[model samples]
Target: MWGRSVPSAHRTGRWDTGGVASCFGSTVEQTASPGRKRGQPGACWDQTGANGTKRVADCRHESHTSHQTRLPQRSRTGPARETPAINHSGIKRSFTAWRASRRGKGLDIGRPPEHDLRSIMNAILYVDRTGIPWRYLPHDFAPWETVYGYFAAWQKEGVFDQLNGLLRRLVRETEGRHGEPSACVLDAQSVKTSSNVPAAGQGIDAGKKIAGRKRHIGVDTLGLLLAVWVTAASVSDNAGGMHLMSHIAATHPRVTKAWADTGYRTKAIEHGARLGIDVEVVQREPGTKGFKVIPRRWVVERTFGWFMHHRRLARDYETHPHRSEAMIHIAMIDLISRRLTRESTPNWRDT
Candidate 1:
């Protein structure tokens, strides 16, 4: 059995040392005279010296009053900790201006917003940059659920798509090119999916031996995104190309020619022609052994490389392919906004 005088535990703040002291936390207490006033005699703990002499050590004393009255002590050992905050560098003034103008012109009659839309947009950029789960969002921004709610509503409403398309035109015009391209490069990439991705939304690419989904994209000579389509990996290039042409025709009908690899040679060309696009297949030379740069084809490949810079696009994690496509647009929006506004590159390493 232990001695009755064995330290039961110590008190902290206004908490007494007893049955529930351990649950509150192990604390060091100071001895005060019974005649001293409450505020005059602060709590302190006894420390043993090297010579085994008992000495009183000072401790911050907090009363049972409200939290506002308590002040935390400063330590010389290290800097004080703070909740992490998302960076605002990813947001551009021009982008915000465009959004405000668009919102004012189209829909300004809704009830007042509970949260700032800019905060939600920054939260999304933070998530896309860090590739973190929605639940793990930092406490500084709006709640993750609220941010995701805005993202889903905007995605379904094609808000990002419209913004990206407008920015692409503005960027092209600034570069002394036509706002609408007469020619584009077509390409498809197979991205593996996460384990949580459902089979109904993804399939295996037999040629690439990748079990995932395929993203077929059309980009102008400047490597800016023009159109995008997502499909199961099992869909052949020709089949996916046909679907993508319809989208391009509807969205970017000014594209009269599309440069592609040999995989989209015959039927793909015929289908594109029927949709009023001349599909030019860039075939590899027969004598080439290893590396050969095909003309115009590398532009689309380079655009895909740009997409790879975003960690969220490295794999298909969304359960719905449409959501995955929306994520790609979100990534492209960040890229294009920076290009158009000369904004500094976002510091993703902070998180």
Candidate 2:
């Protein structure tokens, strides 16, 4: 009976090697032992062969086993942090603070309007520092047209002349309390222009080869810009001498002596006599003297150098001479600012 029952069980294909009951397909191996439940999903077993050799087998479903081998999913966070906006007003306030720290005794003109003054001054400084054309100013600041308009308005209103006068008075008062300047330097520089403005025939000097305008600058012993005048470029340096000396006398009453090159020899002496300034020419040696440079008179040369640093001043581009003159004043203000702040670092290295 036991042999008949075993044959019936085998005939049912429960133990055939090529059937579903084969070792590869059957679940019998998982439930053969009464004490063991099908081990939780991915169980492994150690089986002993009849000769006592051991082998390891996995009881896991193929899908579950493959799923366990994959990498973990990642989170989706964004990119890097950004910087904050600049406080331009705060920067201007800081500059004003620095200006206040260095301010000496003077008439109180309570601070200028924040935006307008700052923008205008910035435009001037930009022109002087970068030596760029006014029309080419960057858009972040005031438009070039606006700045130039304000400059022209100020010139028409005599704002620059007034400011210069005020600075001169302050210096003169200080000098009066101390002593007179030893010597003043006089010189005229010509700015070639395509300007079509008409001026008096007396204002035109044919000798300078300049037909449009001239700027005569006078500097004191300390190389401070004392006075400036704008006239037809045809105006002779001698012709402009009297007016420059008059301006100096009016601005700096205590100037004792003046110096110039041969250009200012004739009329300068006459004007200096009236103003009580002894005019002396820095003489050049005779012969083909390979461009003999004069001392003391170089202060005006230095002033011209300062103006030439601005491209607009390098060539007059304005339709009006007064506009060009206003730009020159702006240049002077920039020079004063740089000198006072000790910010005159050269932008290029000598090559």
Candidate 3:
């Protein structure tokens, strides 16, 4: 009860009032050690029992030091249930209809596939949403090589593109619109590329200050993707826009009217006009300050936002621009399929 002064050397160690040794993250009181120098931080104490037995306290945080206060052994009942972020029933059910349609079209060939179609789709979606390298896919899914093979096969055979069309039409019809849109919005986004992307395929966008590739997409009023084109960032908006509008003209001929930003000013307009389509540039009001949403253009911007929700589309990782376009298509297909199934879009956050 009487204390002239509490020295700083022994400040870190406290006197123990409780003699029992307890563990499992319980507080440990250390007996104060005189001359507890800055470099000498360990505290050990000796206690005498009523039986005249001497008990040594060996509590220390250093390696290889053992203490009587041990934590309980883990129950080790079993591994936790596997909750896949992209392998939910909603996605599988939606894909089932597309697979059935393929069967109806006599799309089957050769022997049966080695891996389950459902597992392959799950692996593909997992890679897209998490942006992990193919080799890094979890062992619980199919082999990474098989998954990539299916992904590339789907792209090369136009299976993904057709699936995208089916999903897009379904979403449009779900929203009370015709399967084909009469009006659309067009836009481009420049994203940096991964190192694996060849220098020949990469370019610098002086406008957005991004050095990589450009994504030109046309979307309907509901923000569903109509077409996507990936090119080097060096390509001007006019060029990308022409390519994009031509795609819309060929596929969604009903999209007679389209809206774009100021970047697609002159040549794109003429190109669209020649294609029997009218392209309008939605400009922000002159006096507007920060982040004003331009009419008929924000929809395409929102579509781009949707692409970013899938981590693979956050940057250009594909070695070929065509594959980049395929990746984007997969993202959109995942989106529209979920929409048709009335399920929430699978996101990395849930993983």
By lDDT, the best candidate is 3
TM-score of each: 0.69, 0.59, 0.70
Higher-scoring candidate on lDDT, 2 or 3 = 3
Q: Number of clashing pairs, model 1?
A: 3
Residue-by-residue lDDT tens digits, candidate 2, 61-153: 432344444546677555543555779899989987876665544565687434456678688668755656678889877888788777768
The lDDT for every candidate, in the order shown, is 0.77, 0.65, 0.79
Over 4 Å off, model 1:
1-112, 344-351
Which prediction has more favorable TM-score, 2 or 3? 3
Tens-digit per-residue lDDT, 1-351, candidate 3? 122353343254554323223434344444444444333334444445887634354334411123323435557554565554675688778878887786778757777557778889989989988899999999999999999999998899988788889888887787787999998898899999999999999899998899999988888899988888888999999998999889889988888898988998888999999998999988888889988778888888889888888899898888988888888888888888777766784335756
What order do you get sorting by lDDT, best first?
Answer: 3, 1, 2
Question: Cα deviation of 66 in candidate 3 (Å)?
Answer: 22
